[model samples]
Target: MTASFEGLSTSAALELLSVGELTPTGRLTEASNATLYCTVAAPGGAEAGCVYKPVAGERPLWDFPEGTLAGRELSAFAVSDALGWDVVPPTVHRDGPFGEGMVQLWIDGDTGVDLVDLARDTRHAGLRRMAVLDAVINNSDRKVGHLLPTPSGHLYGCDHGVSFAEDYKLRTVLWQWQGEPLTGEALEGLAQLEERLRDPDSPVAAELRRHLTGPEGYAVLRRVRLLLHHRVHPYPSPDWPAVPWPPV
Candidate 1:
């Protein structure tokens, strides 16, 4: 049987998400954990232009034993929002007659280059900016596959389930910019984040303590300081797990 959100029944949501009624628009690429489709459904029948990510079946590389990938996706959005970053937000989570799935606002952009490609291209100055954001947020799984570019030259990021690791899992495709100087604006953001992270009552601080080990949590803070003060590049790791095929 397909999994579903705790309270919201999937059967009730399927009356709206059926492919025939809601017209799938684009055949975005598929990953190991989920299949992404551009669709017209507004999640809860609210608006159009939404991206549907359906998590079904097991894939080879998913390491999290907790049955909460959907929840993790939602949490990532929350963290991004808290830090004043733009991210796709979930519309609804349900599992019913249609299957277990999530709907989010579709981010329109050209296929993003992997961190490897971005590192090689000096023209992608925006990538350095992204590096600081990723580090501050403790994003661990930032592969080339997660960054999406738009025809209009805007870049958007996705697939942040393994972020905020609190561990030293700063693995990514963009390690080339490690040790580069951060812009003044980036430093300001890091300073604000450090203050928030250290606050015992802060939501982000509470989250880190709950989800991460003491060393892991400390590492996140240390990396932020390094990014802000030392211009330390992220330590490189070659054996990092590949972005799971068919991203969940």
Candidate 2:
């Protein structure tokens, strides 16, 4: 079992992660920003399997100005939690030899299906459902790589740094579902979301409003409501970036 992040020395954190001693069983992916591997420990163990997303010192194409990358990730997790969506929860944040990084619960599953594959697969109802959620939240970076599919047939999304926009960036691969009819359940969710946005007392709504101007906030709310009420909007084009490249 691996030691907790709190107890790990900077050298130990770097060593364990680099040597694959922490997540002993799985192989790390080459494309991963922070090292990603599966832990050998059982799900509930202190050293249980989890994914580590250490903050990268390299400047990214899009960066957040209000906070550190880790802070933005933590904030997004909080927002998703408040909105009742499942998201990767932060387990620990610590300084390691490499720099600042976070440990999060590992989501054991297959690499998410590519958007092209999902579109080709006729039996993807869950993907369809996710499209609605993506649209509602204005998730701008729903790239093919972000949606994981578990063995049990559930789809989970990740990498939402570009969502909520503070502006209105709704770019995503789920655009195929554009103009599809909204079900009663979807409509109800939107109605609830609208009410929440209208309520100044709600923390999420307040936070969103704080980042966006009154008109911008209303535009977002109205746009979402319109999508729910009318089923779809025009598919976004490359000419106009619906969302900023890096929505900090």
Candidate 3:
């Protein structure tokens, strides 16, 4: 079921993503990992656009186990949704061209907006929410290009394959807010995230456990606790790369 992805509400698009039949449409040439574009179709014949990343195509990392990146992507979406940020377009794990993989509802982002500029600008509310997400996930790669701004004025983030590591590895272009106190809203978001993570049976926690290792999932709550205790944005770690290469 391949049709236009235009004009769908976020909730509607997400619901379709969970149950729609996937049909490969094209390949995204820019992705370093194996990334494919597809159309999702419901039994009723409606369709929408989505991106697919299969585990078989994921590159092995020295630190992370092989074939786990797809799950991290799903985990990131679960965390974002749990926080009610909706910063990550709805994503789910399922069978794909190669094997088990992730399929995310595609966002028709406004490419004209300068992500680098917005990532460095503290006044943008969307950017702030993304920063918090990165911190919570321990995102190791938050490249400027990963920040997608849609025409509907919402900012979505993608490429969360390197997140939720048990160690500190946050590297992003959003360090502009570093050293500043967390806004009241940010603190509240953290509190809510902490609550969700504390319950092993919660939907968000269960979903995350399916994707992340025990240590990695625990790290998420630990990071939330750290953020709440500090009540401020964290500084870049000098031991690791503080920003993604190419920066955009």
Candidate 4:
């Protein structure tokens, strides 16, 4: 029961995670940074399990600015919401018991699914959407284990704290579609995204600017433009490692 996020509607999930009382129930110790498993109860008594990653607990990365990981996670959710891709679960940034952090609805995925098999199948529509998302955000980490497949056949990805860097640092396990044309859905989404980015006053652009530095926010627009121009899935960068370490 602790793992299930069933029945948490998108609106309810966002409201609960944003304004609910967060209590740390446990910790996800395998994570490189401190990742707490928490239960958040809304004012109306609705409760659900969630993951909390405090900015204070983030480990400093040589390539990333320290204490910005939590913001990046929230930024990813904002972009996912804008693209209507449903690739990221409900996430919010607020002051938690430990300080300011990100709280995301816990996803109890179907464990029977095999990530290795899924990663190699570029034809899978959900995975392709995720790949395109990574390219747009310049995701630096996309391990197979990050894939969350639900019993309902919805696939979500997490751990986007390292994404949206100004530099093109896309490292992921889903690379089977390299140099292939993007799906029609992706092209349409990218066009809308470009339009939103072009308008500095757009809500999506404002949300991204709230979390990302000016350069980083501009980089997201640039990446989206590149995707539309090439109209193909990105090829792995020769300078950077194509895939994340310990892929699974």
Best model per TM-score: 4
lDDT of each: 0.55, 0.52, 0.85, 0.89
- Superposed by TM-score, candidate 2 places the C-alpha of residue 151 at a distance from the truth, in angstroms, of 1.0
Model 4: CA > 4 A from native? 1-5
True-structure RMSD, every candidate: 8.4, 8.5, 3.2, 2.9
- Residues 1-248 of candidate 1 have per-residue lDDT tens digits of 12122232334333334431344565465654654565554444533455555556324334454444554454455444445444333344545223665555555555543545554564464566566667765666776667766565555577765665544555556666665666665676668778877887886677556545566567767777777677554555456643332331
TM-score of each: 0.62, 0.61, 0.93, 0.95
Of models 2 and 4, which has the larger lDDT? 4
Better of 2 and 3 by lDDT: 3
Model 4: per-residue Cα lDDT over 1-248, one tens digit each: 01224776687789899988999999999999989999999888899989999988988999987338988998898888878888999999899988998899998888999888988985688899999999988999999999999998888999999998888899999888899998899999999889988998987898888899889999999999999999999999899999889888
Cα RMSD, model 3: 3.2
Evaluate residue 79 in candidate 2 and report its C-alpha lDDT on the 0 to 100 scale.
Answer: 44
Candidate 4, residue 66: lDDT: 34
Model 1 alpha-carbon drift over 4 Å, by segment: 1-29, 36-46, 54-63, 87-102, 111-119, 123-125, 137-140, 199-219, 237-248
Assess candidate 1 and give its lDDT: 0.55
| Pairs with backbone N, CA or C atoms under 3 Å apart (clashes), candidate 4 | none
Error of 3 at 66 (Å): 6.2
Worst 10 residues of 3 by lDDT: 1-10
| lDDT (tens digit, per residue) of candidate 3 on 66-145 | 33899999889888888888888888888866788999988888978877677778788888989999999999899888
TM-score of 1: 0.62
Q: Best candidate per lDDT, number?
A: 4
